[model samples]
Target: MTEPSVPHAPTAAFIGASWLALVAGAATYLIGLFNAEMALNEKGYYLTLLMYGLFSAVSLQKSVRDRAESISVSGLYFGLCWLSLLLALLLLLIGLWNANLALSEKGFYGMAYLLSLFSSVAVQKNVRDVSLVRQAAPAK
Candidate 1:
């Protein structure tokens, strides 16, 4: 009996982007949990949002994917993700500042601000899978 051939699968950029977003979201949430009192305020929330935006815009949008998907849709997804994070960060900052948090604490939040951004870019854009590459016959 002959073995069946395997079919190729199209890479979905959404999965990669989503994974990055998830990691960033998880990390920020964990960090906040670890330092609840320290993170108790608007600055912490702002930091989270900033990280989100960074992931969405700097990371997701920057990924150069050659998937079987339209560029326009990808761009829209990237834009919306980044915009939402930016708005959230702005609101958090405003709230924290209004609450009169210390400057040093605010600055500390900036440290983890790029975690999402980095993850967004770090996520693999192209997933590897088996493909049938034709090979030339050796000279007889």
Candidate 2:
């Protein structure tokens, strides 16, 4: 089988920045949760949504990458990946809508959550692209 035509590897600065964004967004969100005065259940719900969002974002990115490379991703699995990502977003929105936090606080959580998700997707793409390029390189 022919190897896929992988694109150029991600730059060090880009990769570093991707990692930094992910860590910063996630850390800030978690730290906020830790210091919030909300009930334990509410905190747990937000934390779970954050985890779920990150995972689903990564999963969706990988599936998209695989499809781009002409790998055989099942229709059902692909659909599920998209569905999970949407569900995570919907859950976050609904939770925030009914939350007792201030508008600014809700905005803060929303922006940080989105930033974390976007960075995770970028990081996953960078990882897969870099790995593919390295695999295609000739090792002496």
Candidate 3:
């Protein structure tokens, strides 16, 4: 019989980089929003999109990981996780496409938003890996 594979903890550098990317992306996006010349409602829209994108990305990552590990994530929930992440991306694209900002500003927001989403997934994976490693370790 094949033995189940053990979870390995992420390296310190990777963990640190993941967290740094998440923080830098999110902070840059939020700071841009704070300084933008847009109306309050417009700012709120971008803020909401960033928050939604982050949550959906993390949720999708967890769902995918659970399924890979043979954990019982329901089909419906899994589908929704995918759908939510896609919807977040779609909404951001639509928002940016129709906004009145200069091309450079639009590019800036798009890059920061994508960076934040990607880093969130990496951070979530690192967190889960660390947790699994800790759980699998024998008690001292």
TM-scores of the models, in the order given: 0.42, 0.96, 0.95
TM-score of 1: 0.42
User: In candidate 3, which residue ranges exceed 4 Å CA deviation?
Assistant: 1-4
Alpha-carbon RMSD, candidate 1 = 10.3
Per-residue CA lDDT of model 2 for 115-140, tens digit only, reads 99999999998998888888889997
Backbone clashes per model, in order? 0, 0, 0
Candidate 1 per-residue lDDT, tens place, 5-28, comes to 333443456556656664765576
> Candidate 3: which pairs clash?
none
- What is the Cα-based lDDT of residue 14 in candidate 2? 96
Cα deviation at 43, candidate 2, in Å, is: 0.8
**What is the lDDT, from 0 to 100, of the residue 79 in candidate 3?**
97
Tens-place lDDT digits, model 3, residues 21-64: 99999999999999999999999999999999999999999999
Count of clashes in candidate 1: 0
